[model samples]
Target chain A: MGSNDLQKQAPNIVVWVLLLALPLWLPYVGGYMELGSRVVVLALAAMALNFLLGYTGVLSFGHAAYFGLGAYGAGMTIRYLVPSTGVGLLVGTLVGAVAGAIIGPMIIRLRGVYFAMVTIAFAQVFYFIAFRWNSVTGGDDGLTGWTRLPIHLGFTTIDILHNPVAFYFLVLAVFAVAVGVMAWLLRSPFGRTLIAIRENERRARFLGIPVDQHIWISWTISCAVVSVAGALYALLNNFVDPRALYWTQSGDFVIMAVLGGMRSFWGPLIGAAIFVVLQDYLSSQTENWMSFVGLFFVLVVMFFPRGILGIIRRKVAS
Target chain B: MTQVVLFNVFNGLIVGAFYALMALGLSLIMNLSGVINFAHGGFLAIGGYLAFTLMPYVGFWGGLVLAPILTAVLGLIVERVLVRRLYGRDPLYSLLLTFGLAFMFEDGTRFIWGAQSLPYQVPGWLLSPLSSDYFFLTGYRLFMVVIVALAVAGLFYILNRTRLGMRIRAGTLDLETVSVLGVNVRVLRNMNFGLGIYLAGLAGVLAVGQLGLQPTIGSSLIMPSFVAIIVGGLGSLPGTLLGGLLIGVASGVTTVFFPSATEAVMYVMMAAVLLVRPRGLLGEEGRF
Candidate 1:
């Protein structure tokens, strides 16, 4: 609040403190540690989705492909890769990255509704492959017993297996790192190219930028981030199922990003937090909660079409 | 093998009829308004529920006709108040805006109807059994085939023979030009949207017993209807018929042969269609 504190600290540092302290406090006192962690994970996924959809003007209805892939990868790798949570996460991220690279070229060629439909189909195929692949996926029961990150401070090794406190920190730490990376990405020269691509691909092409390649990379990065969320989600639930990768789950993340406002670095985190909390609150109240949610979604699109962040931006601009 | 084939064929034909009904309406609205009415299915659901609600008072036939007419009235209102403002804006906004409307309408129906499945029964006259030497079929299915055939023929005649049809066709090609030429394009657009929605409503009413009515039920049907639109070759009636038959058969065959892969069949088919023929099996180039 004072010039002395402003001189002593940077804005980003204060933001990090706020992000970390909330998880720490929520776990220790508020006692909604699990719900908070879940929100954080969803926020991370929603943020990644917003990059391509909201920021880049691409709408993908099949993002669950990466999410499901990441979860399944993490779950399976942990079953064999053993004891190291970080390695399992790496395994999932890399697997998702590889998958994204392969699917990226095929999907990027489409536009508007066609693109949306293709993504939806791809997600369904991903679900079917997971669902029907009984031998590897364990046929819907999902591979379980995923090991959490074992934190070793050289002389002290803290087993994070099923520890809510440890898991919260894992999610929080990754989220913080992702936010920093995403912020940097947004500010980078390459990010400017992405904006160019979004505004007009033909013009961006005429300007000598490799627009398709840029879109592909953005999509790859987007899917990679979602995969990481999927990994953490698998860890949180201690189970992996094809349901995670279902088309509906993909829609859920899209809804979150749109609700929070598609424009900013902060929109998805706020959106995800609000969405998860709202659903829990609303679903508890009525059997027709979905109807209410659908109505809420309509109102959001019609009234707050640019999103809450967009609202904030307008007010600030004015 | 013959029996299975026959069943698949029958199933395909019947399902194709439903697809044509919905796709016809969707294509009409797109043609006239230049907006892809995403809420078409919502209107369909409303029409179905309206009929379901009216069953106590008017019986089956009354519900069928009245439900769609009521839905068309709602469509008329939507076009006037909300959708008309979106004219000449980006088609994307219309898409998003209509999606929002769809969400609202779906939820509103759920709130009014309650969140449970409702059953639709075939009336006494339509309940008679159909006996054939080669195949055994429900008289209701045969009745559906005949009714849908008549609806399609009636729609075709109206579009070709009527002055209102000429206005809509002219409007679809270019609304601004039509407006400049002294046609009431706004009124045409409103009536076109209402007409499109009425078809969805009728299909919804038809779907009562087959798929039943639920809040989220129409959501699932949206994809298939879209598929029908795609297959039929955007804004073409004949193309839609051929497309619907192809899709229905493809799905029925795939479902019969591989139950697990059944759900994704339509999507897979759509992708294949796009790659091989972007305008659909019956669509012309530059349509997309």
Candidate 2:
């Protein structure tokens, strides 16, 4: 029984170990601290998306809206309202969550492709706001001049700015908390109810589960977690732009979830890691990296639909 | 003030016509195949670029006629090779596949045509205003409206009159029933996709005449098409058309009152429609 339990825990252990030690080993493997931070931030976003997409069987192609809102929220809060990092992160998460909650009721009734279409369209509203609101959003130039401030804990001060390693740790710590909460939620009874809906909504509805409400909750939770990742992303770059909320960015998040194996908890993280690394390498190698990245998406959809971890799991099971 | 409003309203009509053209194509493909074709815009860009490339050989009129046909052919090949495999699977796969294709198309166009916006030469006679009094009514603008009206009429005629169109409508309503009654479902879907892409191509060619040629042209125009589909109504082609024209005019009018809200007014209208009527203005029951 202990051995069986250890087997189940093996992947989790390896994932945490690698993530905690990313800054240590990344430099030796031709990777920088900023890249490690990017991978973690994106992975968090992908995992948050998978919460709704994989577990709840809801496909939101407009998650970039929430992600962007969180980014703009954090950046704006820091730049205009307050200079504190904690406040920025809090405001960012709340803004995205509140927006998701409001939008959820209107869209929860839609299923499949219609839901996707509405979400994508709704995201454009925010994009245009950021694009046209020149004074506030900085328009096409993006919101600049605000840097993530150092945390002021009672005992100590961690200077996230001017220290790449420190910033990476801050990103990792936030990632850990967000991922931990998601993991906890997925293991709860509420999570099982979500899975039931994903597997067969009609049956879950027949069982009196209130399917739409469950989906609404799931969608909001997913948006909130993704916003947390978005806040971290703003802090990492210290710059936020409308591009962060673009539909293509949403597509990137979706691809990460699918490429890593959406069904598994750790799948999107693996997917994000591979995608971030590949994108970094490709952009450096050629100007036509968009084509290569697009080609990668095609290859994954056609051949690797079950994702990398999915293949491994099947092989091991067999 | 009146002149400004009238000019914008006229401008809105032109933009709306483009949206309707693009939306109609998108609606046709979506109704039949269940694929969103995020690459629809990419195909539109291809249509424009193709016309641009062919102009040197075929002249402006020849390019206009040939480019859309050529674009339709490419669409047929793409549907067969890439989009056909994922028909019965989750719609997500197809959406992603096309999303990837959109990226490729944008990059490919930039690579071939250079990222800088290129000049597309229209006939010199069409560039002149029809009259000094209605100076905004350039011959080209009027010409575009006539072409769009003719294309729309032709589309309706085909849908109502032709056997292929009858088969397409039947397939959209119930593919399994249509197949059981001896229609080749695959062929019907393939042809319908080609028809849709043909429209997108046509929109592309006309769009370049107004907006100029750029790789990013398709992406910029696609959102309005989506809004048109949503506002007009799903599963109703006429609704798509009305939705397009309405939003176009609405935005155009908004420009006179609040310029920044020009792009935003349509979205506001869409949200209002969705709030009041979730299925949209002319959307049928249970389509969502």
Candidate 3:
């Protein structure tokens, strides 16, 4: 029992240690701060997606809509509303949340694959808007001429604009808060209900849980978190495009969650790390990278369907 | 102005026909086997590309017939080897597997044929407008519409009349009952999948003539097809057909007034359908 406890705790310790010392050892491993930041941003997105697919037991294939909404929301806020990065994040998150809340009712009736189909279809509306609304959105070339500004924290002015390391830390702090809230929610009664619904909806409904209402709420929360990830993504690159909101990007996020092991808390982050790194390397190395990525997806579904964490957990259980 | 409107409406109907054709195939597979076939568009691309490659050896008419058959053969192989294993498992796995295949198929086509759009040649007579006044009605467009109509008629005839069609419909309604009655469930599903792919292949051959052959062709048409399935209601082949045409006309008409909202109009119609009748216009209750 004691050894089991130690084994369970080891992953947490190792994960934190790696994250904390990433900057120090990254260069030694031929990695840069920007790449590290990209991993965190994508990991957050995948984790946010996992909040629905993994934890809540919902499959939303159109999350890129909310993610893109957050991005555009943040970009538009900074460009048009205010120059404040904090305000941009807030507006961006709210925009995604509001969209999700509105769209949830129309889709809550669908189950499984139908729900996924509808979500993917609905997501195209946003992509079209972004592509067609050229004056504001910058169309296919992407929204440019905007950059993240220095953050003023009352006492100290942190110049996240100039220093890449500062930006990475800022991203990390946001990620921590977002992930912390998700963890706290998962432990609550409400969170348990979400899991219960995922496991067996009829049973949960029989137990007096308002299944549809709870799912709608879960869907909203998932979209909201993914939107925050989207906002962070825009801030990371200082640009947003229609492709960011496309269905293919949604597929990428789903693959990340599945690749990491949906049942585990940090599995998506691990998956994101591997996927982002592989994609970065592949895109740099070959023009046929898409075929490789697609092949990777097939291979994973065939061989690693349980995911890394799932396999590890199984071994431990046995 | 009237001529332009008529032209677009006619054009929309043609586009809608393509949507209906693709969605029908998708609906067939989904109804029987419970797989979304995300790579249906990819199969469509393969059909078009195969036709392109074979045109030198087998004339356009020959390629048109042979390409879809070839594509259907490939689809059978895929369903048997890869997709067959996923049955009796969660629908999620099948969707994901197909999604991956979609990616591979897109990239594979691009690798083989090059990413650039290739022009597909038709007979010179087919290119000319049927009449000078309503110049939008080219011989090819009319020919496409007639072919689609024939295909739909043939499909309905098979489903309603033939033994294989009855078996498929029966299997869709109750697989357990059909299997208990001595129908080979595995072969039934494989054949059903092939039937669906045949439609996709047909769409591909028709589509390339109008849209030109490109790797991204499948991805582009996929969304509208999904909308057609949703709007038509799940599990209803006729509804899928109607939904495709309705959205096509809607978008076509939209171009007359607000050109920018053409694509958005389809989703708007889908949203309206969901609002009014969530089960869809002709969808059976509780089918979803």
In order of listing, the candidates' clash counts read 2, 0, 0
The best candidate by DockQ is 2
Model 1 chain B is weakest, by summed lDDT over 10 consecutive residues, at: B127-136
What residue runs in model 3 are displaced by over 4 Å at the alpha carbon? A1-9
> What lDDT tens digits, residue by residue, belong to model 3 across residues B1-288?
999999999999999999999999999999999998889999999999999999999989998899989999999999999999988876767888889899999999999999999989977899899899998999999999998999999899989999889999999999999999999999999998999999999999999999999999999998999999999999899999999999999999999999989999999999999988988888999987
lDDT tens digits by residue: candidate 2, B1-288: 787888999999999999999999999999999999899999999999999999999989998899999999999999999999999999999999999999999999999999999999999999999888778999999999999999899898889899999998988899999999999999889999999999999999999999999999999889899999999998999999999999999999999989999888888888898889989899999977
- Candidate order (TM-score): 2, 3, 1
lDDT of 1 by residue, B1-288 (tens): 777878877887788778778888888887677677768878889989999889899988899779989999999998898788777754545665676667667778888987788767767666655666445477778877787788788788878889888888777667789899998888888888888888888888887756778977666666676777765667676787676667777777776788677656776776677667767776766644
Ranking by lDDT: 2, 3, 1
Model 2 chain B worst lDDT window (10 residues): B262-271
**Over 4 Å off, model 1:** A1-14, A24-31, A76-84, A94-99, A127-158, A240-243, A246-248, B30-38, B81-116, B124-129, B132-135, B158-163, B231-238
Model 1: clashing residue pairs? B232-B239, B232-B240
Q: Model 3 has how many clashing residue pairs? A: 0
* Number of the candidate with higher lDDT, 1 or 3: 3
Clashing pairs in 2: none
Tens digits of per-residue lDDT, candidate 3, A37-116, equal 99998899899999989988888889999999999999989988799899999999999999999999999988988999
Q: Candidate 1 lDDT, tens digit per residue, A1-318?
A: 898887545545765676678755765643487788889998999999988887677877778889889888888887876666777788888888788888787767666655665566567667778887778887787676555567777898766665777778888888877767777897899888888888898899999998778889999989999998988888777788988987558767877887788877678878898888888888889866766666666566567767788898799789
